[model samples]
Target: MNTYQTLLVSTLFSSALLFSATSHAIELPQLQQRWAEIKYQQTGKQQESAYQALLTEASAARAEHANDANYLIWEGIIRSTYAGAVGGLSALSEVKAARKLFEQAIELDANALDGSAYTSLGSLYYQVPGWPVGFGSDKKAREYLLKGLAVNPNGIDANYFYGDFLLQQKDYQAAIAAFEKALAAPDRPGREQADLGRRQEIMQALSLAQQKAK
Candidate 1:
């Protein structure tokens, strides 16, 4: 992949794993857990294949719970992850589709999974290519990230992604603060595995940001 494409994949994967909520709704939580296992435990083609099959289950869940915000969000999340793993211009469609689902999930209930729609949409806005290539803007990313933070001020995903945005902007100190907040976030009962993985990322990013700060 080219420079931009590689960055896109990396950003999407990082952001994809950011929205692990407290787990709700029987099947939605199941999807969430399954995604975490596939994302954190599996890799390469195995991961891609797992996300592919999960999409089928995600589709069924979304169809079954059309009005459920969590379902829409999870489906969107899975789609985004799959696209990230696939990596390339061709996956842009999946990204767009995921954005739509998140929008719908927000319209139904932004607070469904701790304002995950805002975080998800915000991450996508800033990470994707801009204008003729894709839709990306730092301004929009900050807007949605702040909204997500407002909804869930102490959420792990919210702080972590905001830290990432700050890191990208070269706001090292603020990024450090946000990453620290993410680390201090309360433990998510059913999502311990994902939390472990994410906290590792947090520490790594935090270390880098910290080094850059000095």
Candidate 2:
């Protein structure tokens, strides 16, 4: 190849790489929106299908950005959501896969996405069964939740999930405090619907904890 032809080929290859990166950037926000929609889905079948699709997309994104903590976290979140939608023994397997993804994200950057991995992993530890069935552990759950809070004291998810763990531990007053903090958390741009749903969850849990205390 002559000098001019080699230069032209190199330019084209760089342009293609730029385009691919830009396309993935555009797709990431859409994936987040799809995840929000999946959260509010009313039926199990719909949730299962939506989450399955999201899983495929997120997995592809993770592959493209193998070292990106954010992509890995989203992949883990999608997988965990799919597991919840398909609850049963099989769900445990899915959660385990999600766990590994979250662990990898933490290994890369535990503070990525405002400590999202910690909150998700903490929730997994608490929600999954323990002993003969699964790898759940109250101790690990609290540890992760506290780490999440240390990084993001005012984060809505950090507060809410920590509060939830407290409620399970029967610490009603502490749970109420955490839920209140979650309710007072600042609204995130482009996340209005998710914030609303999370607020509802916080309120319900707060009410239940309050009732239990009485």
Candidate 3:
């Protein structure tokens, strides 16, 4: 082919590549918006419906970007949330599936989505029952949460979950500090609803921490 024709073809290919990347990146905000809305649902039945919808979308996104760590992390997050909404002994299996997704995401890119896998995995470790029943471990929870904090010190999830772990450990003073840090976290753009919800949770935790500290 002539030089001009070759250059035209190269430019078109580059544009196509850019378009593909942009399309994939756009899914993140879409997922976040859906998640925020799902979390806002009041009744358990409503939450269950919302979670199912979000999970369907998340699963599709994950399939589209099978190798994308961000998509994998989000899938895990959505799965974990859905499991919580399901609420019962059976939900443990769903959480375990979520853990596998999170672990796979970490393996692909530990820092993707601001080290979200670490934050979530840490939460699972503490939220699940310990001993003969489940794999929960306070020590592992703290360690993973600290790792997430190392990467995203100002992240709302990192601080809030860490504070929760501390609260569970009865270190009320430290819990207060972490909760305060979470409250001070900058609002995540395009995630206003999520931020609002998270801040409310932080305030509740802070209130309890304060009472315990006193």
Per-residue CA lDDT of candidate 1, range 4-116, in tens?
Answer: 99999999887767744322224877888999999889999999999999998898889878999989988888998898898889778988999999999999998988999
Candidate 3 accuracy as TM-score: 0.86
Across 1-214, the per-residue lDDT of candidate 3 in tens digits comes to 9999999999999999998866553387899888878887465888888888878888888988999999999988988888878887778887888899999999999999899999999999999888787778998999999999999999999999999999999999999999999999998888899999999989999999999989
TM-score for each of the candidates: 0.86, 0.87, 0.86
The lDDT values for all models are: 0.90, 0.90, 0.89
Give the count of colliding residue pairs in each prediction: 0, 0, 0
Runs of candidate 1 with Cα error greater than 4 angstroms are 1-26
Candidate 2 C-alpha lDDT tens digits along 1-214: 9999999999999999998776663256677778888887556787888788778888878888899999888888889888888998989988999999999999999999999999999999999999889999999999999999998999999999999999999999999999999999999988887898889999999999999989
lDDT of 2: 0.90
**Which regions in candidate 2 have their CA more than 4 angstroms from the true location?**
1-26
Better of 2 and 3 by TM-score: 2
| Least well predicted 10-residue stretch by lDDT in candidate 1 | 17-26
